[model samples]
Target chain A: DQQVKQNSPSLSVQEGRISILNCDYTNSMFDYFLWYKKYPAEGPTFLISISSIKDKNEDGRFTVFLNKSAKHLSLHIVPSQPGDSAVYFCAASNGNAGKSTFGDGTTLTVKP
Target chain B: GAGVSQSPSNKVTEKGKDVELRCDPISGHTALYWYRQSLGQGLEFLIYFQGNSAPDKSGLPSDRFSAERTGGSVSTLTIQRTQQEDSAVYLCASSPQPYTANTGELFFGEGSRLTVL
Candidate 1:
């Protein structure tokens, strides 16, 4: 059973546009949510994250919104660039444990 | 090697052979994790270690898979009597204690790819 789910297999966006990636989880105990970006032959790279207590967190061009009631979270990259093209994975974890469950990734391609 | 480091970037072994994967986590990080990724798949948790507490091996696929974290710094994962299904990229990640804060950002290695023939 997949506790975390990224329904969309891929996303495409134009340059300088807003690229949004969505994820959902079935576990209510998960207190931490994170987003990772990966390129070919490389491990995932941390992008952004949000806590259960907060609704929104932003860093530079990237932002993450969490809606606990809906058990959904999204990553938004404003003014998407071609370099932003990659596979994005969402992960959730309980606050105390060392393990984080990951969802099937969404491949994002930002066209220049 | 400021970030997590993994050895044997690529390995090809025949079936029924044993293989060892090593990971060197970032200095001073208290938590380490192992994950597997098959082609076109997401990260699969294999194991993790928190300080001196017993390592969480709940994600191991079977008894053939085992991992050990020595001195809370480096970790090794061993797969015995490996099968063709065990071939995948094994990744290592690390984080500071209280990982929830700071977005729980995990530093990951390039990963070790294993192929069973």
Candidate 2:
């Protein structure tokens, strides 16, 4: 069973526009969530994350919003840049160390 | 040397042959993870290893797959009698601390592509 899901397979946005990626989880035990960005032929890198106790977290131009009641979270990139184009994966963990479940990933493309 | 390193980045083997994939986590990192991604699919967890404690093998797909971590550092994932269905990209990751609210991210390797023909 897929504990985490990213319904969108791909998204395209213009540079300097807002880009939002959504993710949902079926397991209620997940207490921590993270977003990762991956480029072609490279490993995924950490992006942003939020704890279940918090509703929102922000870093630089990326912000993550968590809605616990709905078991949903989203990553918002404001003024998206072409360099932001990559596959983004949503991962969730149930207060564990290395057992995070990942989504199928959403490919985001930013056009200049 | 710097980040999580996985060797045999590309391996092609015949069905029924055993294959070994290696992972060297970042120096000083304590938690290591193994995951595989098949075509058109998401990352599939295979195993996890922590310092000196028992490894978590709950995610292993079958009895043919086994992994071991030595000296709390290097790890090897062995797939015995591999099948064509085993073809995928195997990824390894490491973290300084257990994935928690305090440490929410992992450093991943580029991944080892295994092609079982």
Candidate 3:
């Protein structure tokens, strides 16, 4: 069973537009959620994260919203740029264990 | 290297052969993890190592898959009698904190792509 799921396989948006990616998890034990951005031929890098205690966390142009009631979370990027064109993976862990379950990832293409 | 380092960025082997992939995490980092990504699939957890504590192997897919971290530094993932389905990009990551209040962000290495022919 996939504990974490990202239903959208790919998303496209024009530069300067908002890009939103969604994720869902079935494991209620998960208390920490993270977003990673990956470029072609490279490993994933940490983007942003939020704890269960909070519903929203923002950094620069990236923001993450967590909805514990629905077991859902989302990553929103404002004024998406071409540099943001890459695969984004959503991950979650129960606590400080550091073993995170990841989503299938969504490829975002920002058109110029 | 300043970040996690993985050897043999690409590897090709015949089915039934054993393969070993190595990872060197950032110095002083106590938490290490292994994950694999197959074509059109998500990153699948494999195993985890934290400090001198016992490693977490619950995510190993089969007995043929095993990993070890020696001296709480370098780690090696071994696959015995590999199968074609085992082909994927193996990713290694390390974190500075594993037991305290932290951001839970992982620094990852450029995965090693394994192809079982």
Candidate 4:
């Protein structure tokens, strides 16, 4: 079963616009959420994360909003740049210091 | 310090063969993990290793798949009697602290792409 899900397979947006990516989870035990960006043939880089205690977290141009009641989260990129084009993956940890469940990932394309 | 590093970026082998994939986690990091990603699919949890604790192998698909972490540093994932369905990119990651800390972020390697014919 897919514990985490990213419904959108791909997204396209113009440069300098705001890009929003969404994710959902089925497990309530997950207390931490993270987002990672990956380029072709490269490992995913840590982008930002949010704790279950907090509803939102922001780093530079990236912002993550968490809604516990809905079991959903979102990542927003402001002033999206061409270099921001990559696959974004959402992952969750159940506070066990063990395995993490990852979403299918959303491919973002920024058109300059 | 350098990030996680995985070797043999690409591998192609015939069915029934065995293959070994390697990963070197960041120095001093105590937590390590392995995952697999098939084309157009989500990442699949495979195994996890923490300092001195029993490694979690529950995510492993079958007995043919086994992994070992040597000296609490490097890790090797061995797949025996490989099948074509095994073709996918294998990824490794490490965190400075155990996942329970809730503050550590997972640093990933570029991943090794395996192709089984």
Report the C-alpha lDDT of model 1 over A1-112, residue by residue, as the tens digit: 8899999999999999999999999999999898999999898999888889899999999999999999999999998999999999999999643478999999999999
* DockQ per candidate: 0.67, 0.70, 0.71, 0.64
| Candidate 2 lDDT tens digits, B1-117 | 598999999999999999999999999988999999887677888998878889999999999999999999999999999999999999999998756346578899999999999
Across A44-109, the per-residue lDDT of candidate 2 in tens digits comes to: 899988889899999999999999999999999998999999999998988673578899999999
Residue B55 C-alpha lDDT in model 2 = 90
- For model 3, the stretches where C-alpha displacement exceeds 4 angstroms are none
lDDT of candidates 1 onward, in order: 0.92, 0.91, 0.93, 0.91
Q: Write the per-residue lDDT of candidate 4 for residues A1-112, one digit (tens) a residue.
A: 7889999999999999999999999999998898989999998888888889999998899999999999999999998999999999998987753367889999999999
Model 2's number of clashes is 1
TM-score, cand. 2: 0.97
TM-score of each: 0.96, 0.97, 0.97, 0.96
Best by lDDT: 3
Residue-wise lDDT of candidate 4 within B13-98, one digit each (tens)? 99999999999999999999999999988788899999888999999999999999999999999999999999999999998777
Question: What is the Cα root-mean-square deviation between model 1 and the actual structure?
Answer: 1.2
lDDT of 3 by residue, B5-54 (tens): 99889999999999999999999999999999999888888998999999
Instruction: Classify candidate 3 by CAPRI docking class.
Output: medium
Error of 2 at A37 (Å): 0.7
Ten residues in a row with the worst lDDT in model 4 chain A?
A: A93-102
In candidate 1 chain A, what residue range of length 10 has the lowest lDDT sum?
A93-102
